[model samples]
Target: MDLMAMIENAMTSPVIYLAILALATLDAFLPFLPSESVVIAAAVFAVSGIPSLPLIIVLAALGAFVGDHIGYLIGRLLRERRPGGRLIRAADRIAPHLHRRGGALIIAGRFVPGGRTAIVTASGATGYPLTRFTFFTAIAAVTWAGYSGLIGYLGGVAFESNSSLGLVVGLGLALSITALGELVRYVSRRRAAATGAG
Candidate 1:
């Protein structure tokens, strides 16, 4: 079945929420799954009163956190094995920038497609302290869940009210997230350059 149809089916069942959470967590490590659609669909269901919004948000965040931590652990393991493992070596070019604007990079990474995995992996490879990593990771997960959920909820609201408005809003939210990712990258690069020069 197509994505929308799959989402619709899942939404109709009680297992949809759990599945979404699991998928999102796995997506963090795998980096190829469609976690965004799952979250969006859950939000749509929540807005339609099929599930509670708070629960949706909480579960989504939990899943994201779990996935991120798993990725981090993998990185840590690699680091422990070799100071300059494959993961660290690949991320080295951006490590300096990531370290400088760590918080912003983490947050922006959550919004960027395929970024969640990269951030978590990079965080691990960089040897960011566990405490600091968890703190910033939570922030990123919450922001991602909130932004995606809100957009999906708004889409549901528009579906109930006006289709045109819902379409516009959904598109706008997607575009804004993409733009924010670009901005974050730009800022990080500039910061890294300055730090290197100094």
Candidate 2:
């Protein structure tokens, strides 16, 4: 069988849920793993009813929640033991803004690939309130999971005859959204810099 067909068979197994959870968790800290794509693929298969869509969203959210907590703890440790660490230093520099808009930033960053890791780690390093962090992170995780899964589901519906094409469409949508977010952020930063200079 071809590679994709083999992968599709493997993903259809019962253990795919656990795989989804694991990948989502690792992607939070690792940032390089294609957890979003995996979720999208599973969701594309979900249209076929092999894996439940709601379960995929729930597991992905739970995994992201747990992984972010780990990142927070790691950042806290660095702040305590390595005050001069690069991440800690960076966190220190942005601590003021993080303190002011931590909730919105956390939620928005969760959608970006590496931005989530950086923001969560910085939040910890800066000792941002745990209560608020937990609340915002929960929101971020659930929203992210739902958004990713639904996008895939929609793609699958649009291309019901071709699951692979559905996966591509879902990924394209995700990348487009991320790019849009980056553009917005860039423009905001430029405006803020101009205001500061004025």
- Indicate the residue-level lDDT of 179 in model 1: 84
Clashes per model (N, Cα, C within 3 A): 0, 0
Note the residue pairs that clash in candidate 1.
Answer: none
Q: Which prediction has the highest TM-score against the true structure?
A: 2
Give candidate 2's error at residue 14 in angstroms: 1.5
RMSD of each: 3.8, 1.1
Q: How would you encode candidate 1's per-residue C-alpha lDDT over 18-68 as one tens digit per residue?
A: 887897799888877867666666666665677666777888888888899
Estimate the TM-score of every prediction: 0.79, 0.96
Q: Which stretches of candidate 1 lie over 4 Å from their true place?
A: 1-7, 161-172, 183-198
Off by over 4 Å in 2: none
How far off is residue 36 in model 1, in Å? 1.4
Indicate the worst ten consecutive residues by lDDT in candidate 1. 160-169
Q: Residues 1-198, candidate 2, lDDT per residue (tens digit)?
A: 998798789768889899889988987789998888888888988998888899999999999999889888888998999999887889999899999999998999898769989998998999999999999999999999999999988998888898889888988998999999999989999999999999
